[model samples]
Target chain A: MGTQLDPEYVRTLRSDFAVAHKLLSDRCLYESAKWSAEALNGLPEDEVDDPEILIPDELKQLDQMSSSERRQYMLAKACFDCREYDRAARILEHCTSSKCCFLKWYARYISGEKKREEDSEVILGPLDGDATINKQVILIIDEIEEHFRTVAAAVYDPFLLYLYGVALIKHKCDKLAFEPLTRAVNIYPFNWAAWQELGRCVQNVDQLPFVLSQIPPTHVMSKMFEVSTSQELFQSTESVFATLAQLENIFPSFLYLKIQRAMLCYHALEYDDSAKLFDHVVREDPHRLDDMDMYSNVLYVTE
Target chain B: MGTQLDPEYVRTLRSDFAVAHKLLSDRCLYESAKWSAEALNGLPEDEVDDPEILIPDELKQLDQMSSSERRQYMLAKACFDCREYDRAARILEHCTSSKCCFLKWYARYISGEKKREEDSEVILGPLDGDATINKQVILIIDEIEEHFRTVAAAVYDPFLLYLYGVALIKHKCDKLAFEPLTRAVNIYPFNWAAWQELGRCVQNVDQLPFVLSQIPPTHVMSKMFEVSTSQELFQSTESVFATLAQLENIFPSFLYLKIQRAMLCYHALEYDDSAKLFDHVVREDPHRLDDMDMYSNVLYVTE
Candidate 1:
């Protein structure tokens, strides 16, 4: 017979279950499932049937099972919930649902309690904006958005609105993006990602050209930029200017759009207009003029 | 000689001031200070004195200042608020007062709104945890902690406790760091940094040796490690175990401490004890045995 487990060890085992409950309460279902499975694995056989000892969330609802239950999604989610991300990714690959596809991508990106080797791997590379998976997700989301746009109810859904806005901005259709993202942020100010993306969409007026000019010899960003820099992204410089000007009505303090308009003028060789705009940009922050270099470039061109 | 600023330009100026006010209201003082300074720099001579235009937070309170008060700290903070990090870093170097030392360290770390040239630099190296300045700052913080520990009131101060705890952990005195950190986290649950440091301290029972062994020949971490693997850092392993055991009484579910204990035993060649501990660990989470490599090594050694 197995020697009785140390009481502290048993308490720790139970606590993992409690931690899972807390995670579940916070909607981190995958982590919760992992901890629950841990608790079960470590449970003393004598206490196995005790509800208070290790009562799972759904165990109480076991009597209410319906016959037509399609549980593959649930099983896949459970696998994810248990921190079996590799397995979850495999399960998601076979699933045709858009959520599953997103989950497949998500499983690859989001990590569990990061241990040493994984952390060292993180330390071996650059950390910012490496969410390259977002691009593919954006494409998937774009397809979803197109399908939803046809539905009357979808226009009112904030999540769908956020997705649509994100997709548009990713595709360099920022003019079409502003309304939905603004609306999404209005509905939920807590979306730091949406706020950041909205800020970018508003800032970048000629994204297609900018992306092309900025694409490194070796980039680790989204493939969206590699295949697509369509001139169609910019309807016309004047049209872009007009739309940006219209946006300034809502965000009058957004200096980025002002600079974009200046650059557009500069590119068109409207030296007087460009000079006026550059002067205003320099005037705004006379100290450490982040725009001073640009203004100098304008001067070089005009001279 | 300069023509009166265009009406639209003046309107944008006013709007920027309004934006600064909103940022200030949200307690984003740095961004607000920056925007305010921008508006001030942009203002026409007539509008420059207009209190309605870009009055920074302290402008109304300026009259209350004592005659001996120098405003270098305020000016430095203003520079920081404006996101002129490099300039702020330069300015901070000349300020020798210990009070300003923390501010100097802070300025170097919190970057300005990241622009283009810097984006490529991040991709060229590991992106995050480049807090290499932690080594230099640890010495400064050590001095601060030493002074604070003598003051009766300092123990009650959460910030002081946090600083002390952080200094201790960073200096590899993690064993002795538990008291202040535990107190700090007890006082403030939202101190994610404190919690993280606390977790690290608890987990790293034998960090110096582990780090020495784990250091990849071509690692990109700070040169501080290569310089400072001194022998005095390690005390008795039994003492560390005893202290950890004491702590686990309060934090019974500290799996990290448990793993640390198991590893310590494994290192000491107490294979029977380690095997039992490792069994519990594997039983706790069968999937993604983050310590599988070590566990296998232990098995090989034991067999």
Candidate 2:
């Protein structure tokens, strides 16, 4: 049987649980928060009796606080972190609006959450009121554009256009998303993520090369291969294998490159090279055990 | 009339021409090399007489050599660089096949170049009718594989297999191209190039993802908007504008992205944003004057 737990060790464990409880409660991870609180409440007072098993300084700090007070503090912090401004505002209602609720609410609004009437005016009031919110959004986006007008510009601030564009895209306000993303790409020709998202945006429209050419040469090649390899283009195993081989050089480090190559080799009856590359990858990475098994099955049937 | 060229200036230009000549000659960029050589020959003989010209020492040394000898030397270097081994071998026939030539020939052969019968292999010996040469080539390839394996064990080298696979595919060796590209992707999950090529390879032989996924998610949304805007997917002007607006954020600074967006916006009758982006790009980069003219035509029609 396992040795009996030390009274001091049990006390230490209970205190550590209290910190996690406070953190989770603040974040509104309610279930985890409640469970942590309960666990702390259930700690036996007898464990505190043994001097050798005394609670550590860290846990003792929480000893003075009531469970309800700790829960409220943790819950407020969590809501703020998760950008649940309304919930956070309710918890921190006694605090100044501008200091606490206002910033969080603005961040949420910018992240695409619909704003309350009070929050809406507070956030949108800074912009020219004569212009519609959509137009105001456009102006803000334009400001970002002016900042990144050169190739050397630090245009990849995730807070600026990237988040704004993502919000606009998700909202189906594509008209709004266009300028900011284009400005971002123009400022940094090497931003592949922007180029890819752009390709996805204009794929249905005529004249794809215009969008494609804007992407870096390497990214364009990769996107081309991605579109080509997907089942959207072809259905046959033979054609799939053939296409994969053509793109091998562009993505040499990819495991799929070798597996597809091995598959094609098996089909071609070039067993030697196929076996060698396959075995090499499997041996190097145990994570590919499943792939090796599947490959072996194919080889068995083909042979 | 302009003052006579400075002697020092003439010498400097001549030296610049000589360096250019050497680089071009080394690369077998024959036409450029000849131009530089001719420019050196054309330098004025008397430096003091041409005050505007400044001939450098390097150009003076080159100019002292007989034109015939220069031509011979340039031709030999060009032949060597171009891997016209027999031509190089003939020129250096009196000299035993140098170590450099042998190594060069061996490297070329391993890179898949066929060996010429007449060329002497002093260091590695004739590759033809020699099992040892084939074995050595394989060993070298294995060594390269081992080095890559040690450095980037997680990533496979798709280039070699890809090259062979592409050759096989081009030769209707579909079975061959399949495995290498598959292997390429397996090694690198984010290899978009592999994915696109794989799609193309299977397009002819299999049921494409187009049939399976049934209109990509983006296109489905586009079609919905197209219907709402009373436009066909590719036919209606509104559809074009909608598509461009959508793509703006996705491919922000891409010149082609802007052009396509502008084109689509013109079709959709959203002339303002279309013209603005177009005008901005053209105004920012006058080198795209031709594109501006095309955009202007679109604007005229849309307006």
Candidate 3:
């Protein structure tokens, strides 16, 4: 264990796992999150049994394609998967399938973001740090919003609605993002990414109930969103704790759930209890360096 | 993208994903690592098609159990999954199956680590910092070493050998760890965790060739290990870079692979090439904050 955890490489790995875990949790890929947590503790990767993803019928209709078209589609997909976004967009320029359209526009959006990361020369206002994106990125967002808006108007695909919603959110049109995101969750509530986007559009705690009414309130995903949003806004800790406890039962030893509970305890001014919970977390996952900044505060207060 | 990436919550998330990425890379779960990279870039979760894990026959014999025994086994499993390690260990005290024995001992070992994390009063040597573990943990290592030494002599389970090797390593018995870890990689070469432990036992570049000879020469895992260990010792970078480039072709846009190449370029004093690669990685994964310390160093030198 000393050989495992005391090394400089392990320290670097601990920090990296922290970031990955947060992303996995945000995506509501909790099973993957569990794998990360185990990995953080120097536990070996247990071969997991993930449910198979059914390929959409449209995607499965490759047999109907001309060989050249099939080759183009396959090549585009390969390019897209490798993050060669521009090449993927170029190859799919004339493909008329819904998947192709989504892919092309999505690639364009990502390509634009990549450009933004490279565009460090953009002058920032005195107050702005890395948050001020380049005009090129803004142009791409506008293009994404325009394309997704048109595509979503014609089709009821949940993913299309989600992209439309995300584009709107990116363009800083949260009011416009609202309906598409709601439609997205209504169509496919299990996609936590859509729910998270919807959660972002929500302005305040008072607006949450109305937003909650618009989607499937009984869904565990909605409950998760509610808990997340409420925690973000620092409201209704008691109910959030209860809901999280329920989620804990569902996702046993979920690191994110435990961290949230620990945060909730801190928020409630249960300093000793929060400290203990944080201690428990540290004990189980000693290498987890993220989220424990709050634990540090808890320790400070208790000490 | 601004709304997604600019918020304080998102800043926290970026740092978190950094840690999680490192852990996932260390575990060699690159498919899940890809998911994390996407998540960091604010990409929606794409439904993945993960291959199913085959259940070993020993674990599949649950149907042959008496109803009461089955109930007991499931209860213990539930307790174990929730991280009630002590409860799980107690529940499996009388169980005799190989799986049960592994679980029982593994739970006990984890429980010991947890206790050590909570043991805050242990005096550290002047040179020791957070690396100084409590006596309780050391005691558990001693117990684990003794248990595994006896158990491994009678069984050829790769996982058992892994645990035994880990115990010996913890007990400052790397000589003992070497054979078990070698046996582990020989028996189950795909387990990156065992390979990592084996890698730790290697003292210098001179020892690497002999170690490499013990494992499957043509296996991709072995190749990955060779690249990893070579990079760690900072020897044979030209060959290591070639291996990593081959791996990059195999796993397109693998962040860790890209980062490794960047580091290798930096090591070779190819600052311009390394800077360009780092810039590309940053653009593709704008939210990745870990491994960019080297990027910062590159920038400092270039400036």
TM-score of 3: 0.45
Report DockQ per prediction, comma-separated: 0.03, 0.01, 0.03
Instruction: Quote the positional error of residue B65 for candidate 3 in Å.
Output: 14
Q: How many angstroms is residue B67 displaced in model 2 relative to the true structure, after the best TM-score fit?
A: 54
Model 1 pairs whose backbones collide: A30-A81, A126-B127, A127-B127, B30-B81, B34-B82
Residues B1-303, candidate 2: write the lDDT tens digits: 223555675556445545555433333333334334433434455423212223345333323333223223333333443344444434322321222222223333333334333343545654433322222334434443444455444434443333334444434556555666566544422222333344445533133333223322443223322222222122445445555445343323335445655655555677787789788777643333324665867677657
Question: By DockQ thresholds, what CAPRI class is model 2?
Answer: incorrect
> Against the hidden reference, what TM-scores do the models get?
0.37, 0.21, 0.45
Off by over 4 Å in 2: A1-159, A175-179, A182-192, A203-205, A218-247, A253-303, B1-303
Please list the C-alpha lDDT of all candidates, in the order they appear: 0.45, 0.42, 0.60
Q: How would you encode candidate 3's per-residue C-alpha lDDT over A81-129 as one tens digit per residue? A: 4456776677667766545655666667777767766755546744243
What ranking emerges by TM-score with the best candidate at the front? 3, 1, 2
User: Which candidate achieves the best TM-score against the true structure?
Assistant: 3
How far in Å is the alpha carbon of B71 misplaced in model 3? 16
Error of 2 at A67 (Å): 37
Give me the displacement of residue B264 in model 1, in angstroms. 3.1
TM-score (0 to 1) of chain B, per candidate? 0.32, 0.27, 0.67
User: How do the residues A122-239 of candidate 1 rate in per-residue lDDT, one tens digit apiece?
Assistant: 4435532332223344544555565555656533443345556756665567878777766655543323344445556634445445433432322211121222112123233554
